[model samples]
Target: MSGLLGNHFITQIGILVNDIEKTSKAYSEFFGVPQPEAFLTDTLDKAQTEYNGEPSVARAKLAFFDMGSLQLELIEPDEHPSTWRNYLNEHGEGPHHIAFVIEGMKEKIELLDRKGFSLQQKGEYEGGRYAYIDTFKDLKVLVELLENDKK
Candidate 1:
């Protein structure tokens, strides 16, 4: 559990929020999740969703933290009718999405894309390159690809 290679089928849940500190504090107070000592950089890109039979890049933001074995990610975007921001603005922000960690990210992205999962955003963080896909219908949820789990 200490090492990334173990993987151990971790379930990563996320909440999208417009304010980082506010959401972090909220989760910490409510769920007893540990607070991060420092902020990490998350470089994001414009993403598109094909759940509606068309594709377009909506607004998005991402942040990360660890909760024991589960990885908690926070995403918030300015809405032009987007999933993250829209959910936060509408539902009031708690457990927005979840991710399953798997190996071979490049092939997974290609395979998921070929299977109709649309790419929303792609970026590189300290851990690895990640691609968020809009699996809006297939999983009835947004799927975030967590890669380079080994540090």
Candidate 2:
């Protein structure tokens, strides 16, 4: 089914964790998949990260476990102020956001904004960009928007 963001396909489920090594190992063993190596996100200049409407230097170590059509992502954030760091601090380590892959990033963000969903943070990655929207009050989880560059 489709929603305000357009398509309803959930591409990823992000979790905040205190320890990436231990947690990723456990998940790997449980899922019978090789342990995915954790990698640091891009630096601030490359990532062009913004948090709470201001530029930020936040970064995180991330590991992804591909589960069929969806991915389970583990995030261990640094001390900087970011969506990952803030959520990890406030909620202590658990499910953080459910992400959807979309096409028009700017339009989707604007639509969500019109609906009163605040954009908490945004950043760029190697292949795509992401935005974290504060949809916790209604959905019990933040909603992430992933827009990959067309190859």
Candidate 3:
């Protein structure tokens, strides 16, 4: 296994919300930051999505707040069987996951697999790929792995 953890950096904090617009406004007001524009995941290309290791077309409304080096992400899940939706259904709306940006995604995924973390969900965007690892039982939060395209 590769030194995935050593090479990774926590870059984002993700939250699951029942309503994206309200949550975004709340967060913006609380943090004194401007409310971010919401984006729909289904509108993006290269959106290869999955839930619980099965192919899925789950979509979500997403908003992001830039907090210097880290970002705060708010996700409002549609009526779909996605990780976000499941979290919202089972645990209500709250902090869901923390994301790490890394270089070698496949190697890092293999390392996490060897360490017994199951991949709960995955998706690919135009120039990046992301995976959610089921670490809530141990860490009280899911872990997201992000790999951006190399320029």
Q: Pick the candidate with the highest lDDT.
A: 2
* Candidate 1 lDDT trough over 10 residues, lowest sum: 43-52
| Per-residue lDDT of candidate 3, residues 28-81 (tens digit) | 899898899999886324587878777887899999999999999999999989
In candidate 1, residue 94 scores what lDDT? 70
- TM-scores for every predicted model: 0.64, 0.97, 0.92
Evaluate model 2: give its lDDT: 0.94
Please provide, for model 1 over 86-116, each residue's C-alpha lDDT reduced to its tens digit, 9 standing for 90 to 100.
6677678676667767688777777778878
Q: Where is model 1 more than 4 Å wrong at Cα? A: 1-8, 37-65, 78-92, 149-151
lDDT at residue 150 of model 3 (Cα atoms): 90
Off by over 4 Å in 3: 1-4, 43-45
TM-score of 1: 0.64
Better of 2 and 3 by TM-score: 2
Instruction: Score residue 118 of candidate 2 by CA lDDT.
Output: 90
Runs in model 2 deviating more than 4 A are: none
